[model samples]
Structures are given as structure tokens and as C-alpha cells.
Target: MGRMSDEPARWTRATVYPDMWVDPADDPRDGASPDGELATLLDFLSGYRMTLRMKCEGLDAEQLARRSVPPSTMSLLGLLRHLAEAERDWFNWISDDDPLPKLYGERDGDFDGAVGEQAAVDAAYADLEREQAATDAALAEHPDLGERLRKDGIAVRELMVHRIEEYARHCGHADLLRECIDGRVGQ
Candidate 1:
């Protein structure tokens, strides 16, 4: 059973993913090397992605599909599915220029995979894991983080800082969405 609603609030705040939360990396002032900013960013992204996954850990199929906020079709499961597509879109299509077609049926239904049942949820997560792995491997293949990618004739870093930004932004969304779902917040 869940905690009694009538119980006095013993805790000042709830965390979105208490068990999954990680302390920030050592500050740059600790005499550590100033290099590896890309690596640091990537680590942060990986942590946040795991946090997003952890936030949905115990929810069932229906609970995962439940819209935590009103007037919004976004669900925790939907965010997961969307982020997965987003990862592929940026890394596979934009960064590595893979000619592979998109997943999740049609273009508009990327997030729709989050709906239906537990099987759908599992599949979405699996897709995300696979895509993330491939992307990571691709990133590893390129040692030059400063390599410029010609995107529409504009140069972009191959280090994936933009993808890190994307994950951070969406993780913020996930934090709020999870909070609305069960009053969970923090981290």
C-alpha cells in the first residue's frame, strides 16, 4: 500500500528520482584538468537519461500513459519515446548522417508509441536503449570533438553538446511531469 495521505509531512520535499540522483561532478577548481568538457557533458546527459528512466520505474502501463497535467498530452512514457526519437534524429540523421529511416511507424506518431499497454512502454524503452547505444558508439569513433559538421552549410561540433542540452531540457520537463504525477520533486 502507499503512504497514508493523512500522515503528517515528515519530509520537506520529494525527489523525482531519489535512488537515481547523482551528485554533480567535482568542480573545476579542484585542480582537476580543465579538459574533457565534452566528456563531462556526456556523463551528465547519461545520468539525466537514467534519471528519466528511473522516474518511471514502478509505474504500470496505465499509470505510465496517464497524463499528469491537464490540457497536455505529454506523459512520462511519451517523453521517453520522444527523447528516443530525438536522439536518433540528432545523432543518426544529423551528426552521423545515417540514411536509415525513422522508427515508430509514421513521422507524426513517434510519441504515440508511448500509448496502449505495457508492451508498448517496454518497446519504447528498448528502442531508446538501442539508439542511445548506437549513438554513443558513433560518438566514440570520432576522437576529434572539435570536428565541425557541415549542417546546411553551418559548422557544428561533433561532440554533441547540443544533444546534451536537449537531454537537460527534456529532463527538466520530466522532472515537472513526474512531480505532477505523484507529487514527487527535487533532484
Candidate 2:
């Protein structure tokens, strides 16, 4: 018989990747050996990005847009939208001071737009791609990872680290949300 509880245990041993990390001890931020702190940060961000992608793979638009949890506006699609905005907000706005307007519109709930629809899913992914490319370009132009950016008079490196932290947290959310949606989870 199925449990009567609404709160389901979403994760299982079979669903999670057992050996995803190459070497936990080997820090990605090891100094001066070609791959510097910036490279390490980028690599870490890319890893989470790929993880998010894998978590959503094979899911249809409706599934991707499902909220999975009650009282939260955090669908996989919403996360994609949020991340794209975050990338642009930090790299394009704070770092480069780009004047480009925000994507996905200006409504407070714009990220939640077209929820459970194929068009929304496609738009979220496309926004992510565009924002990611812009972030890479901005990073490429900067080159000096050590150079500090003063955003609203705050240090830019601090903001960048915060951005990385934000993605890592959201990826964790995606892990659980994806598992809840379809019992598929890993990496």
C-alpha cells in the first residue's frame, strides 16, 4: 500500500552518482599551475551547470516546469531563468556595467512565466545559453582574476564567489526536485 503521507522521500541510493568527483582532496583553486582561481571558479560553475542539465534531461516541458514542492516557486524552469538573470546581473551589470535591459521581462514573477509549457522551457534554456555566453565573454575580457571590481562600492570577487555559491545551492535544490519529479538523480 502507498504511504498516506504527502511528504515523500525523494532520494534513493540508486538514483545518486556514487563516484562523480575525481579527487575531492585536489582543490580546484590550486595556485599558479596554469589553471588559476578564475579557471577553478569557472570549472566549478560549469560542473554545476552540467549537473543541472543532466538532472533535467529526458524530462518533457511540463515535467521541467513542475514545482515539485508546495509553497515554492522553484521549478527547474524557474531555476534556469533565475540563473540566467543572476549571471547577467553579476557579470554584465556589476562587473562590466552593461546597460542592457533584463531578459524574461520586468515582472516580479516573470521567472515563473509560461510555467508547465514547452515555450517557457525553451525560452529558459535559451536565456541561460545567452547569459552564459555573455558571462564567458566578460570574464575573457577581464583576464586578471585578481583585479577587484567595485560594484556599488563592494568588491567584485566577493560577488562572484557569491554567485558561485548561489548556483551550487540551486543545483542542490535541482537534485532533489528532479528526483522528486521522476526518480532520476545523479552527479
By lDDT, the best candidate is 2
* Superposition-based RMSD of candidate 1 using all C-alpha atoms, in angstroms: 5.7
Q: Which 10 consecutive positions of candidate 1 have the poorest summed lDDT? A: 22-31
Clashes counted in candidate 1 amount to 0
lDDT of 1 at 159: 39
Report model 1's TM-score to 2 decimal places. Answer: 0.73
Would you list the C-alpha lDDT of every candidate in the order shown?
A: 0.65, 0.70
Model 1: how far residue 102 lies from native, Å:
2.0
TM-score of each: 0.73, 0.76
Per-residue lDDT of candidate 1, residues 1-187 (tens digit) = 8766732222213244343333234222123333576656666676677778766766688767767556667787888788778777756443645456677668646655568597888888898998888777766766566655445432235337777677778778877766655655536
Residue-level lDDT of model 2, residues 1-187, one tens digit each, is: 9768645444433423433321334423333533677767776777678767867777898888888657777888888888888887776554645467777666645446738888888888898898888777766766665566555553545656777798889889988787678665445
Whole-model alpha-carbon lDDT for candidate 2: 0.70
